[model samples]
Target: MTQPTIVFSPLQAGVPAAGGALEVLVRVQAPDRPTDLATAHLPKRLALVVDRSGSMNGQPLQEALRCVTHIASHLTSQDALALVVYDDKVDTLLPLQPMRSTDAVAKAVAGVEAGGMTNLHGGWLAGAQQLEGGTEQTVSRVILLSDGQANHGETDLSAIEAQCREWLGRGVSTTTVGLGRGFNEDLMIGMARAGGGQNYYGETAADLYDSFDEELALLQAMYLRQVGLKLLPAAGVIVEMISPAQQLADGSWRMTDLAWGAEAWVAVRLHLSPGMAGQTRDLLAASVSGTALDGTQLQAHAPVLQLPVLDAAAMQALPRNETAYTRLEELAFAKASEHLRQLAKEGDRQATQQALDVLEKRFGHHPWLSAKIKQLRQLADEDSEMMAKEVRYSMMRMSRRLVSKEEMAYEGDETHVSESVMPSFMRKKVSEGKGKKREV
Candidate 1:
C-alpha cells in the first residue's frame, strides 16, 4: 500500500478588502488510504486527569471513565497513557504505562471513584509530573477535566498559571475541559492558554464523550508537529499573526482553538508599501515535521505565498471588488481597539476612563461599545471586587464582542444581571419609579 501524502494549495491572495486589508485562502489535503491513519504508533505520551469531586459522583464520573477507556482502546501498545484522579487530594491511578496492555488500562480506569473537593492544582501537578521525562523527539500532552472550582488545594490561580507556563516551556502541551456549568470556564480557558493547548466545555456526560472522541480523532490525524510560519516580508511590507499563539520550543506553532477541525481556516494580514506597483514578494514560509502514526518523521515545506504589492492608485483600479477583505479589516481594527482599551484600563485607570469617554462621544451609536462603557461605569461605581472580576473575566472571554449581556454568574450561583442594569450616568438620566428624571 502507498503512504498518503498531505498537500496545501493557495486559493487567493493580495485582494483589497474593507479597511485596506488583504485576504489569503489555502486548502489542505491528504490522499485517501484503506487503513485508519490514526492506528499507526506515534511517539506520543498522554496524561488524563479526571475530576472525581463529590459533584462528579454520578453521570460525570461515569462519562469520564468511559471516555478514558475509549481513549486507551484507541491507542497503540507503543503509546503511553497515564491516569490521574483528583478531589481533595490528587492520586495517579495509573502511572506512565504503555497502552498496549488492554487489561491493565481497563483496570486502571475502572478504579476511579468520586468524593471530596475539587483540587485542580494538585491534578495539574500530578499530570505535569507524569509528562516530565521524555526523549527529545516525544510529544507529551495532558488532558484535564473538571466539573467545579478549585477550592481544596492551592487555590492560587496565578501559581497554577505559572506552573502551566513552565510545563509548556518543557515541550508538554496541556488541554483543559470544563465538565459542566459548575466548572470555572475562565480558569480552564486561561490554563489552556498558559499551557499552550485548547479548552473545551462539556455541558453534560454525553458531551464529555463527544469532546473526548473529537480530541482523540484530531490527535490521531496529526501528521505534523511543531508547525509554524515565518514571514519574511520585503521592504515596506508588514506581516502580522492574526491568530494569537506563540511558537513552541520545538519551533512549531501550536494551532489555536480557531483552527481546530478540518473545516477551520487560519488567516494572517499583510501591509504593503505605499505607491508600490504590482510586485510579487515572499509572504511567509510554513515548516512542520511530517510524522506517520508509527513515529516515522519526514520534512514538509509549504512554498511561500507570493503577494503582489499594489499601489493606492492601482488598488482603486482593480475589477469588481468583494467586501470580504473589507470585513476582515474591520474585524481586525475592532479587535485591536478593544485590546488597547483593555490594556489602558489595566495599566492606567485614568487614561482608560478618558478614552472611554472619548469613544462614547464619538462612536456612541455602536450599541456594543456603548453597552460596554455603561458596564464599566457601573463597575467603577459599585466598587465590588466580585463584580469587577466577573466583568474582567467576561471581557476576556468575549473579546470578539464589545459587550456581552449574558452575564457569567458567580460560581455556584444563578443570579444574573442585564446589560441595561447599569445606565451611563453621563449620557442618560436615571429613572425614578416609572418616570425618567430630566438631566440637569
Candidate 2:
C-alpha cells in the first residue's frame, strides 16, 4: 500500500478580480498506515510535571492525582518516568527512574500534594533535568500540566521559553496540558512550540485523561525531530511566506505547530516571471527532510514546478489581458496571505472571528464547512473558549473538518451541558432556518 501524502496549503485571501502576479498549486502525499504513520516503535523517556497549586485543592487536584497515578501504572519496565510537582518551588517527586517496579511508581505518584503558588518555570526546569540524563534515548518527552498562571519562581516568559529551546535542541519534545482557565494558554502554547510539541487545554479531569492518552501516543510514535523544509527556487523565482510559521531559521525552517501524534502540512507560494512569446519557463523547486528524534532519516522531494506557456500574440497581450488563470491565481494568493496573517496573530480573538466570517461568506454554501461553522458558532455561543479555540485550530491545522464528534462533545461538555442534547427550541430554530432557505 502506498503511504498517504498530506499537503498543507497556505491560507489565501483578497485576491484582486484581475491581473494578479502569483499562483499556487498544492500536492499532498498523506502517509500510509494511519495507525502508526508518525509513531513507530522507539525507546521512550517521559517526565510528568504537575501543578499542585493551592487553587487545585479540590476536584482539580484529585483528578490530577488520579491522572498521574494512572499514567505511571501504565509505564513498562523498559520505560523511564520522572515526576516533578511544583507550587512555589519545584519538587522532584521522582528522579529519572526506570519503571522497573510498580511499587516505586506508586510511591512517587502517592507523594503528590497540592500547595503553594504556581511556579511553572521551576517545574519545567526540573522536568528538563530528568530527561537531560536520558540524552542517549531515542524518544524523550515531557508532559507539563498546570492549573494556573505563573505566580512564583521565575515568572519571565522569555526565560521559560529559553529553557524550552535548550531541551528541544537536545531532541526532547514537550506537550503541555492546561487544567482549567486559570492557566495561561498562551504561555503553555508557546512552551510547546518552542519545544516542538503540541498543546491542550483541559477543562475537567476527564479531559486531562484524554490529553494524557494523546501524549502517550505521541511519545510512542514520534520518529522524527527538527523536521524542516528548505525551498530552493529556480533562478529568478521568488518564494514567499510558509504558512503556520513556527520559525524561519537562518539556514533552515522549523515548525512545532503540528498537533501531537498527528501530521502537519505547510503551504508555500512562489512567483514566476512573465512568459516570453512562444516560450515556457520553470518556476520553483523545494527539498523537504527531517531528522527523527531517534536519529532516523525521513525525506521527500518536490521538483514539481508550474510553468506558463504563451504564444507570441498571447505574450504581447499578457500585460493588458485579463485572463481566467490570472484571476484565479490572484484569488488564491490573497486567500493564502490572509490565512497566514490570522494564524500569526496567535490568540487574538477578534482577528480569528474576522477571518472565520470571511471564510464563511466565501465558502458558506459548501455543506460540510457550513455545518462545521454552525457547530463552531454554537460552541462559541456557549462561551466555551477552549472548544472555540480548538475549532479555529482544527480549521487551520487540518484545513478540513477532521475534528471528531467526540472531541466536540468533550469541548462542549466543559460547561457540564451535553452539546449532543441541544435544547428543543434551538434545534427547532435550525430546522426552521433550513426549511426557509430551501423554500427560497
Candidate 3:
C-alpha cells in the first residue's frame, strides 16, 4: 500500500528563475476515512492523573469522577489504564492493568476524596511512569485533569514541560484538561505542546463528559507515529521552518506524530540569492519518515520544488495558487492572534486593536476565524489570567483537532463562568439568562 503523502504547497507554485525568497507549506496526511480500531490492533496505554486538591472537594471532584466513568466505558481489554490522584501527595489508585469493568473503575474513582495542596508535577510524573517504555505500536497518553494551582512539589512550568518532552521521545504523550478557572492554563498548554498531546478546557460537568468522549475518539483513531521530515536544499539555498519542528545538528528537522483524521502541516520559508534568468534549478528535496499502524516503517519524498528563472514580468504573470496563499494567511492569523493576546494583557489597547484590524482585513471572510475574533473581543476586558487562558485555547484548538465538546457546546448553551473572577458585565449576563429558553 502507498504510504501517506507529504505535499508541498508553495506560496507561488511556480517560482521565478531569478529567485529571491519562497514560502512553502508542507502537509502530511493519510487517506482520509473513518478508522476502524478493532482491526487496527493498536493497544492503548492510558494514565488518568486527577487533581484532588481541597478546592475540588465538592462539584468539581464529583464531576471529575463521573468523567472517569465515562472514559472507562469506552476502554477495552486491549487497553491498559492507570489512575493517579494527587493532593499534597501522589497516590496511584489503580496500577497499570487491562481494562476490566466500568463499574469497578468508577467505584474506585468515587472513593477518592479531595484534600491538601496540589502536587501537580508529582501526579503527572507518576502517571507517566505507568506508561513508560511503551512501544510504537501502543498509543500511550497521560491525561491530566487539574482544577487548582500547583502548590507543592516541582511547580515550575518549564521544568515540567521539559520532563514531558523527554518522555515524548519514548513514545508517551501527555494531554491536559483544565477544569474550572483555578488551574494555571499556561502550564497546562505548555505541557501539552511539549509532550505532543492535545489540551482541553472544561467549564462544567457536561463539558467534562463531552471532553472525555472527544478524547476517546482521537485515541481510537490514532495511526501515525514518530513522524519526521528531512529536507535537502539544493546548493546555495537556505531553508527555515516556523512550525513545531526540531532542527538537528546536520540541518534536518524532526516532527512528531501525525494522525489519520487530523493532518499535520509545517510552514517553511526558503531563502534564495539572485540567480541567472532563463534557467531552471532544483530548490529543495524533501522526504518524510514514520512508522505505520501495522509496524511497517514508511517513507515518502515529496516532489522536488524547482525554481524557474524568469524575468520579473514573466514571474508576475505566472498564476499563483489561491489555496496555497490562503494557507499562508491562516498561519499569519494564528500568529497575530497570539500577539494580540499579549498586547491585550499588557493593556496596549491601540496595538491590540491594530492586530485585530489586521486579522479582520486578512481573514474576516473565514467564518471560523471571524467567530474566533468575536470571542477574542469579549475577552478584551478580562484580567490577564482569563485573557491568557482564552487566547491560548482559542489559537491552539483552531490548528489542531476539535477541542473537547465542552468548549464548542451548542450555541446558547450555558457557559460556566467563574463568579469570583468574571467581570461584572459577564456575571450579570449569566445571571440574567439563567432560566431562559433559547435555541442552541
TM-score of each: 0.59, 0.70, 0.83
Residue lDDT tens for model 3, 312-429: 8887887776555655655666677788878876787667767778888878876556665665666565454455566767665544432111122223323333322321111111
State each model's CA lDDT, in order.
Answer: 0.55, 0.56, 0.71
Indicate the TM-score of model 2.
0.70
Better of 1 and 3 by TM-score: 3
lDDT assessment of candidate 1? 0.55
Question: Model 1, clash count?
Answer: 9
- Let me know the TM-score candidate 1 reaches against the reference structure: 0.59
In candidate 2, what are the lDDT values of residues 224-258, reduced to their tens digit?
45666666666666776534445545544674322
lDDT of 2 at 197: 75
Query: For each candidate, C-alpha RMSD in Å?
Result: 12.8, 9.8, 7.5
Tell me the deviation in Å of residue 226 in model 1.
Answer: 2.5
What is the RMSD of candidate 3?
A: 7.5
Ranking by TM-score: 3, 2, 1
Instruction: Order the candidate numbers by lDDT, best to worst.
Output: 3, 2, 1
